[model samples]
Target: MQGGVMRRRLRRRFGLGCLLVGIALVVAQSAAAEPRRLEVELSQLFDRLDSGFSNWQGQRLEFQSARPGDPTWYGAATHDRRYGVEDEGVSLGAAVPLGADWVLQPEAGHTFDADFLPRWYADLRLQRRLSHGLVGALSLRRTEYQASRVDRLALGMERYWGPWRAGYTLNVSDVSTAGTPVGHALALDHYYGERSVIGLRASLGREEEGLPGGEAITSEVTAVALRGRHWWHPEWALSWELGTLSQGDLYDRHGVQLGIRHAF
Candidate 1:
């Protein structure tokens, strides 16, 4: 009888232990089903910014279509076309993260135009996040244009405040025909809710023209862009953007773009 009693006691302890283990597993599975705190997105854009008047009363257009993907690593391909002119180009780029706080981006492109020789260009960029709200970047670009070559370096900084973000870019460039010039740009961006954003950007720069003794010219470019997006499900979204660009002695150009994106 004592042996039977001890056997029942052992069986009870074993079953109780299994019951506790099953409850713990249920709790772990519930926790695992919760949403993640971080998010990653990939997107593509088609942009058209144009302004100019010609002797033939034609408008100049710069259109670009690009497919870009972003994760821990990123990549992009872009095709650029000019209207009323036989000029077009394509670019491919990639970005990789080096460590916790730094990223490296490298890009290359080729351009073909009737007025200019086939040109090749390459760029490299380094970026780091300084804090929760601040980021900094440095970039360099080299291009071979016709009989001349151009090299440029740029520095940029950005700050994020709540839903509003602001940034600046400074650039210096050396052209084989026109020496060197410095340029500056400023921009402001606002995010509305989770799926809408608006931005205004302006840039003032000095560029060298390789004609009539290659003089330097000052130019200002201004733009305003608004974008809206709607999420149909967890992995799908519909997006729209409207933008305008204006410059001196140039006709203002306006554009509208719409697309759908899916995340995996």
Candidate 2:
């Protein structure tokens, strides 16, 4: 993860994580945002990026075994780029809950960039129920990306109003490439029925970078998405998302995702 590629990888992971959470919540039962019993999930996402200079296509696959408030393990594979000099990799990780309000996740993987590089990451989060319809979370995360590393701190809050739920997240990251990046995300969801939901999400960010010879560059990123999920039976659910991204004014991308989950 050197220079521009590092930033790209970080952004991709950010968007994917958010999409997964949104989908799970939408497909959840009326009383919970995730399956309370043993569950398995599979997901796929595809994106195309156009930067007026080059075109990049990305595809990702994820599989997970989950049990709410317990331990969960996941595996993911990502392929991004059309040319031979693309980024492709696989990751494996696990999340374990500590007590009622804390979760710790650790992951290790490898990526085949110019060569093969080892990657590892860890996340620790604390979530609390604030009031009748409010919840808040604070988290810290670190990623060791080949030659570069990133450290991030984030805060998030969610509020429930009637059939609607809204959330906001703010984060700052210390990137090994360029400098630091600051971002915020907003999400709004409406539960149409007991087992169906629709959601809208948007995110914005600014990253500062330092070039050779003391030059500086500022990168801006924006993402917007629409998603929905429904449970057709007590044990099966489906989710989908469509999204677009803009990196500065020259780069733009569009993506689609689909997922299925089953509880036993």
Candidate 3:
């Protein structure tokens, strides 16, 4: 009996020890032209496997419907918990071709009733295809709450070499009540078999958190994640991710998310 208990403990730790999470399942999470991507995901925290896989304090249910195009407009709704508090929000976004090599993306989200989650958030990004199978992007985001606001700027570059892609991003951020912080992230991914992919990411940075009663804290954070998806059928895919995060003397997080996706 004792040994069985020990095994269970090890099972949980193994996944946590590997690394935390990501905007994982690459091809399975994003829709392709004329095909739609639908996913259901679960993690210990509100971890959306988006381009920015930032984990918040609550669990969430999210759904997205992408419009028809190479990379077009999409809408999403999220009912998530933040710092153990619950909140809900809906978002709409679009990606428009600026020219032959450039694209512009704009998005906005709002919560009917604000809580730990922001009352509203918005962002705009510009991406350009560069020489030598490379892409570059710049983005700015603003998240507003009842009493404080957070702003962020990011610059990124990515390179494609055959079936592999490598990317790096730099982020600078400030909060009305917290200190400024900078972060760095690196990612590598391999694609094959029409719509299957495997990816790994690592990030390190300083983070700011607004506490209750207008207080706040700043800390250093480190995270690593591995995510992948395999399509067993033309219309179905299996997705999974493992991740871990270390925060300066605050807490250590290790978790996983398993999802099923459908292409329609």
Candidate 4:
């Protein structure tokens, strides 16, 4: 009986994740055609996954504001319910531009549950556009977990071909929990005029989870995601994202995110 329930949850999560990702990508691509100075986005996420202990269902609400060449801010509230426990959390983050091509993003948040811990993260990125329709970025990130801290470095490159673009990113991380891990991601997107876009992305990485007694479990993480964006008007757009996360055969999750945005 328990196995049946788990399977059902997994299927639902996968479907929802796909739907959400698809819509988000569509809207984002569409909105990029006529860029706005001030943008507001609201999103909802439905997720199901295992986190070492039990399977949980998460409902998250998020709000974001972005200004091109300036700063972007986001906040989110999440509720997770499982068989044995319920958890809630609120998170906020900001990405601020340091120059024409540098951005610093810092995020901190606290979760309410048995753990009741605060998490902190920060990332610094430098990006530049080349003369030949190419762009590149380098970034470093630090994340503080309850029992461990991790640092990651990434390099990314992108090429633009008319209305289609492709990007690749390579990442490496060092940590006590996950040991040394490496990953990479690829993305491709095509624009249909200035009103719509479709994109696909995939990533494979290694991550560590902290366990009791100062121990950690290392796992391989993989995901494939799709998203799309469409604009109904110059001022309004819709987007969706769908993705599946897998950690070998032991753990799997699917999520869907839906978003709507308006520009001032």
- Judge candidate 3 at residue 233 and give its lDDT: 87
What digit string (tens of lDDT, one per residue) describes model 4 on residues 1-264? 000000001112221111111122212222333342444555556656766645545555555554344455666666655444555666676555555444454555555442322254566555555546666667787755567777889898777666676878898888856688888878787767444667787878775543333233557878887876676896787867788888665677777767676667
Candidate 2: where are CA atoms >4 Å away?
1-38, 53-59, 66-69, 72-75, 82-84, 92-118, 192-195, 207-218
Per residue, candidate 3 scores C-alpha lDDT tens digits across 1-264 of 000000000112122111101111112223333444443333233343333334454333333343323344455555654354556667666566554567677778887666555677788877777777777878898877666788999998877667787889898988777779888888787767865777787888986554333234557888888877677886676666678877667666666766565555
Ranking the candidates on lDDT from highest down gives 2, 3, 4, 1
- How many clashing pairs in candidate 1? 0
Better of 1 and 4 by TM-score: 4
Candidate 1 lowest-lDDT run of ten? 1-10
Q: Give the C-alpha miss distance for residue 38 in model 4, angstroms.
A: 3.3
Candidate 2 C-alpha lDDT tens digits along 1-264: 000000012225333343222222222223335453544555566667665434445565655565444456666677655322466777766555555444455555555552222255566655554555666777788765545666789899877667777889898888776578898888787766554677788989974332222223447978898877666886787867788877676567787877776657
Q: For model 1, what is the alpha-carbon lDDT of residue 30?
A: 28
**For residues 10-76, could you state the per-residue lDDT of candidate 1 as single tens digits?**
1000100001111111111223333322222233333444544321111111111111112122222
Error of 4 at 25 (Å): 20
Per-candidate alpha-carbon RMSD to the true structure: 19.6, 7.5, 10.2, 9.1
With a 3 Å backbone cut-off (N, CA, C), the pairs that clash in candidate 2 are none
lDDT of each: 0.44, 0.58, 0.57, 0.55
Best by TM-score: 3
User: Runs in model 4 with CA error above 4 Å?
Assistant: 1-36, 48-56, 59-118, 193-195, 209-216
The model with the greatest lDDT is 2
What lDDT is reached at residue 12 by model 3? 20
